[model samples]
Target: MSISIIRLGIDFGLVVLIWMIQLIVYPSFLHYTTTNLAGWHRKYTPLIGYIVGPLMLGQLGIAIYQVSTDFTFYHSLSILIIAAIWIITFLQFVPIHNNISKGRVSESMLMSLVRKNWSRTILWTLIFLSSAVQFF
Candidate 1:
């Protein structure tokens, strides 16, 4: 398959995974007890990272590669959007998750995490659709 096809597949997969995490898995965190919350979150972070981290890196790298080669307005715009997602992930989400993993399970923080995560979820959805339009 072509490189664009691969990028689209990766983008679509990440979109689906993030939606699931946002809608289902994260909401479930509210139910865990404080004692188990840390352990649960600790275990959960790495496990989910195992799946998501590579896909994210792949998407970012491919976006950069595409823009580097083509440098079209749309491709560069896509890269900017993808970079924003990475920035949101590292700057906002990771620190939030780190707090949670340390047993700091405030309802406000949990709510913030869920709310902020929508940035990634929505951006990934947009990215996938944009890529589909570009590719198909």
Candidate 2:
């Protein structure tokens, strides 16, 4: 019923959307292109990647800001979790993708990045859910 509660709900929804994109939509999109469109790798999909990747990062910002701006008496846990996730995203995920964008990396590198970064994803998912509890 309050602003913080609304923000938390929106944040949770966006976080779930992100997980769906990463785990479902992206892989399916790539897989479909690999089969349905020959030469997708040469230009088309990479261009889409350039756009979609940044969009995902933007969504992350949305979630982070939503969580950060919501103030509650016990907000420290939410703040700490969002801050940690943001740091991990900057420190761990960004560099690997930077390499990819520069042609200095490979899919294997990104997969490696994801594997290493899985904990952050799970942690943030938990953070989103836990933050939602403040509404109750």
Residue 87 lDDT, candidate 1, scale 0-100: 89
Off by over 4 Å in 2: 25-73
**Per-residue C-alpha lDDT of model 1 across residues 1-136, encoded as one tens digit per residue:** 9889999999999999999989998888888887788898899999998999899899989988999999998788899899899888889988888988998788777877889889989999999999899856
Model 1, 110: alpha-carbon shift in Å?
0.7
**Model 2 residue 119 CA deviation in Å:** 2.3
Clashing pairs in 1: none
Tens-place lDDT digits, model 2, residues 1-136: 7656665665666567557646764344334333342343335446755754554455456555655676454455555666676687679866765554445544465457546656665875776677677667
Each prediction's RMSD to truth:
0.9, 5.6
- Candidate 1 to truth, TM: 0.96
TM-score of 2: 0.59
Clashes in model 2: which pairs? Answer: none
User: Candidate 1, which segments miss by more than 4 Å at Cα?
Assistant: none
Best by lDDT: 1
Best by TM-score: 1
